[model samples]
Target: MDSNKNTAVISVIGKDRVGIIAGVATLLSQNDININDISQTILDGIFTMIMMVDLKDNVIENSDIVEKLNALGEELGVTITIQHTDLFDRMHRI
Candidate 1:
């Protein structure tokens, strides 16, 4: 765990099913990724979840998180994405 706090967003989309949140959360916990905030909902059987995570303590590279999530997405039949909050905020800034 590092001292400098870094932030990122993890987004998930998929057919509504069980264990989606649990699986993702478990992985983050295992990897020492801290969840700062989360929003999740299921609409018309489509599941969507967004997790804002703190990576300050995590030593794993962002690329590793992305790859693991991509593989997890395949296993769970979902689309998973991760992007730094700084870039996300910049892109959406008006």
Candidate 2:
């Protein structure tokens, strides 16, 4: 198995609705990002997803990914955050 140390975490949170997965997955796929792991669920009609994506050798840069993801967020009415594994680990560590 591949290590997730270099992967990025993308979190999406918004009202439950259609096309959330499609929109996010499409952007990642278009950028050649590989989805290492994904988990999603609905809580009180709000949808939330955490995706671990591998972007080691993709055409898109980190800034570009942020821009694209922001665009998707705006379009979907969701709040999206993207973070590097190291930063995320540090921030979320117990």
Candidate 3:
């Protein structure tokens, strides 16, 4: 792995439904983002997923990933977020 590669912590949350995984995975694949780790489950019809992805080879910037995910989330009736690893770690440290 390249040390310069950026990593993003991504989370998806909402009521369970079809196409969430396909939508997210397709977008990531299209952008050259690789999912390094992932966990997903549903409870009482609510869907939740957390993923760590390497964005070093991304075709777009980190901010654009956030925007695209947000838009996709809206279409899917879910909440999708992408945060850079540095910021994610700092935010969790408190």
RMSD of each: 3.6, 3.5, 3.4
Give candidate 2 misplaced runs (Cα > 4 Å). Answer: 1-4, 58-62
* Per-residue lDDT over 55-88 for candidate 1, one digit per residue giving the tens place of the 0 to 100 score: 7755446348888999999999999998777776
lDDT of each: 0.84, 0.83, 0.84
lDDT of 2 by residue, 1-94 (tens): 1334557889999986789899999988988888999999989888999999897775335358888899899999999888777776676775
Give residue 46's lDDT in candidate 3 (0 to 100). Answer: 88
Pairs with steric clashes in candidate 2: none
Q: After superposition, how far is residue 59 of candidate 1 from its true place, in Å?
A: 6.7
Each candidate's TM vs. the true structure? 0.84, 0.83, 0.81
Which regions of candidate 1 fall more than 4 Å away from where they truly are?
1-5, 57-63
Report how far off residue 18 is in candidate 3 (Å). Answer: 1.1
Tell me which of candidates 2 and 3 scores higher on TM-score. 2
Give the C-alpha miss distance for residue 15 in model 3, angstroms. 0.7
Candidate 3, residues 1-94, lDDT tens digits: the string is 2235578888999988889989999999987889999999997888999999998756446347778899999999999988777775566665
Candidate 2 differs from the real structure by a C-alpha RMSD in angstroms, to one decimal, of: 3.5
